[model samples]
Target: MPPPQPRTHKAKPPSPEPRPSSSILLISPENKILLLHRVKTSSSFASAHVFPGGNLSSQDGPIPAPSSPERHVDSPVYRLGAIRECFEESGILLARHRDGGGMLEVPDAERERARRAIHSGEEKFSEWVKKMGGVVDADALLPFTRWITPTSVPRRFTTQMYVYFWPLSGAGQDAKIPIGGDAMIPTPTSDGGLEHTAAVFQSCATWLEQARRNEIIMFPPQFYLMWLLGKFFEEGKGGAMELRVQREKVKEFLKGSGANGVPWADKVMSPVPLGMFEGRAVLNLDHPGPELKGSGRRGESGHVVQVRFSKEGPRDVEVRDAVEMKRLMGEAKGKL
Candidate 1:
């Protein structure tokens, strides 16, 4: 028999394949975007603020055409899922007439009932849309980008981001307007205490400011999108211009994915900032920045670069390892 080898360290296990999910970026007429604060008890995003979205259900049907192009064949279901999840998570409904007439003006009572039923999973999304006599507002939404969770996570998601801008003109169409009518505006409310506990709307600049103070626990995708939005706003790119560019980019990605008839995902992947253990998913980044002492590009574990937010500056220093991670987790009763 061979001699026993000394056990020094254990390598992390590989994560499972990422599952597809969809989310919607609900842009208001005032350019203020909505964000939902996940419930602290939530299994996935726990206490982090995120956009209104969720996993796709079997009820999401085929891609509605004329609004969706043929090249985006694989994306319509995602779009449908996005719209459906947006309505369920946020009170705002994005559906409109198939003939591009106007959005359904759901009354306060009806809205409350629909929201409750949806949150409790007592009513199906397809049935609710049917009750309102409308299909998913596939035409109004523009596919924007994709975000994939880091490989360090045991479970992962490849989220599809879709953006829908509130109409600048009247609510109903006069027969000459483009795809659909103006979306009906509603105050967002969070009823799913299981997923989200609260909701708020803020400008991109304000959001970036909060990120600097570490008031919001944002992942790389959220952090990166906020950075991009701030830059775009600074460059004087109006809401319409930004959405147009995003729509064009989505088309490019879709068409490019069809080259070899194999579906390819256009995902913006970012490295994990904190040290992970045994392929565990990151729960939160509480007060993450270089402002803290010893917070830099390296730690006891590996490279620990901080994603810069506005306000505080960066510091250049030698790389260090995160030897205390295991110790800290141990002190905290195995909680990371």
Candidate 2:
């Protein structure tokens, strides 16, 4: 028998660098935001209902200098990726006619075909838009916030969150606007049930209630953003009034938050795990992470999220306000 070879342990590969990605909160005119349900077997955010987003591609084009000192170095790339992903995953193309006539009007059949071609790499997104004689309406995306995945995760992404108020003007006769109005809006549909299972526009509060009741899983970022948005549109507002009021209110917020044309302003969040509360993990929403010390970016303090993780995925998310978060943390520290 051959002598046993000396045992040698293989060294672990280095963790991947955080990829630049973008997510869009597609705020409908009806005071709701579009959410896509990821398949349960997804590599990231498995089984979670999340905003439309994906990693940037080389076809997204070269990164420009920060739009302002407050914007990330890759802000332009992020914006492009956000628009492409939103269209690929949700069938809502954010672009306009090349001659600046108005929004690009494509039949649903053509839209679906183009979406498949772009998503499958048969053609680049930019090239496809140009082929259709349109320019991406990236300017319509308003910077909402940015989130860097925690270091503990094996795969990480620096995702820029954007708010896009879908315009319902100049729709073709074949458009499907769920609301009772005659105005036509781009219909949202899943990408052939591949990456996402469903694409639906539902109110923030309704989504929050669903997550709270364990009907769907939402990661902390989605949960936190929805919690913030829920504060603006209450439940009792009437139909069209709710839409108009919410649109104006959100526009005001974006204008106020994104003062001086700096992306995200002070709303960069890098959650740091402080401890566990009950069976859930408690994270410090305000921490800028060790890598970002002295970066000057800050999240709203005194707010925390409790999320439970299982082998399946993250579930049971709860965002605690200042008072409740203080009580929870104080009790954990034996100071309450």
lDDT of each: 0.57, 0.77
Judge candidate 2 against the unseen true structure and give its global Cα lDDT, from 0 to 1. Answer: 0.77
User: In angstroms, how far off is 99's CA in candidate 1?
Assistant: 4.3
What are the per-residue Cα lDDT tens digits for candidate 1 across 217-254?
66555654555444434334446556556545534543
* Per-prediction TM-score to the true structure, in the order listed: 0.63, 0.86
lDDT for each residue of candidate 2 in 80-137, tens digit (9 for 90 to 100): 8999999999988888889976777777788889899888888899888888888998
Top lDDT prediction, candidate number = 2
Lowest summed-lDDT stretch of 10 residues in model 2?
Answer: 65-74
Highest TM-score: give the candidate number: 2
Q: Compute the lDDT of residue 66 as modeled in candidate 1.
A: 29
Off by over 4 Å in 1: 1-14, 61-74, 172-184, 234-305, 308-336
In angstroms, give how far residue 3 of model 2 lies from its true place: 28
